[model samples]
Target: MRINADFTQRVAVHFDQTEWVASPAAGVERKMLDRIGDEVARATTIVRFAPGSAFAAHTHDGGEEYLVLDGVFQDETGDFPVGSYVRNPPTSSHTPSASQGATILVKLHQFAPNDRTTVRRSINGADYVPLFKDDHETVEMRSWPSGQVVPIDAHGGAEVFVIDGGFTEQGEEFARWDWLRLPPGTRTELRAGPDGARVWMKSGHLSGMV
Candidate 1:
């Protein structure tokens, strides 16, 4: 089953408007943004766990990265509250559960072959840092101030997710939880709304794993 699986093109979706599809685990559901293959696939999703819900122990064969959007997500190692960003490298395993419930943005099977770093931290505590740097690829988080216009030049494609507040792009408004992906060589403009915004931005990584 493939959905927006093409890497050469662009894809965008507002998760707030997407339906929640149930996962194999009870009380857990997902809004898949892009996917390839079947049940075990390369995917990006917004996952929700109901109170007291838990997922069976599993290993990340390709890798897993996620950011908690709400409530608390827990595993054998520790509890991750909202705003927590975690990366479990290839071959890592864990039993994840939610005591009060949680919503998280997750990416699966998207790691580079030699990218084996394991990271876990709160977005609030970490300063903006470059995740990748190359002639065609770059990833970083930056501040978006209210009423400010920011230009974007997507040399090899780009993706953005609003982490707080809201913004407008090409006259379309995007609020918290909204995500956008643009094709290669596309030029775009972003204007922050009255509430301002904070965003996670990734450039390139659209045609190949970075």
Candidate 2:
């Protein structure tokens, strides 16, 4: 069960641009971008939980990383409101639910073994540090103004989420909630639209594998 499972190709799946499909969980709905499993897979997705909805507890064999795009997300641990960044590294477990509805950009089964742990960050308190002129790194979350180019650094590509506002690159337009996976060694430049987009971006993990 492989859906865009290969890391050698450039893949982009838009959430707003693509329709969603139902999940095995009663109140949970998912739109899979790239996959490699059963009803659940090694994919990137937009998952929505209906009010008071929840999934049974389970182990994440390959880890889970996600960002709260809208509403409030909760589990036994705590509640993550919009603009939260989370990382549940390899061999972690949880039963996630949302009582007030929620939307998330989630990447599954992607993590370095040494990275095992759980992370919860309030992105609103994060700061953007300059990696280089015209290129910056946000250890947190924030906006990238229109026409601002941030190269993905050709040596190792990147993954991106259009969380708020919209972004365009190489003639591709990504609206809110869109997910993109650019393979290692691919150069990318993002230009925000009139909305002056804010995106959650990550890179350098494609090389991590079982």
Compute each candidate's TM-score over C-alphas.
0.89, 0.86
Q: Against the true structure, whose lDDT is highest?
A: 1
Write model 2 residue lDDT over 1-210, tens digit each, in one string.
677778888888876567778787888898888788885567778899999888899887777888888899998789999877787878788899999999888888765556655677766644342211113112235577766766666445567777678888888988887777777777767778887877777766564421
Candidate 1 per-residue lDDT, tens place, 4-88, comes to 8666665668867899999999999999888887778999888999999999999988889888899999999899998788878
What are the RMSDs of all candidates, in order?
2.4, 4.1
lDDT for model 2? 0.74
Best by TM-score: 1
- How many clashes in candidate 1? 0
Candidate 2 residue runs with Cα over 4 Å from true position: 125-142, 208-210
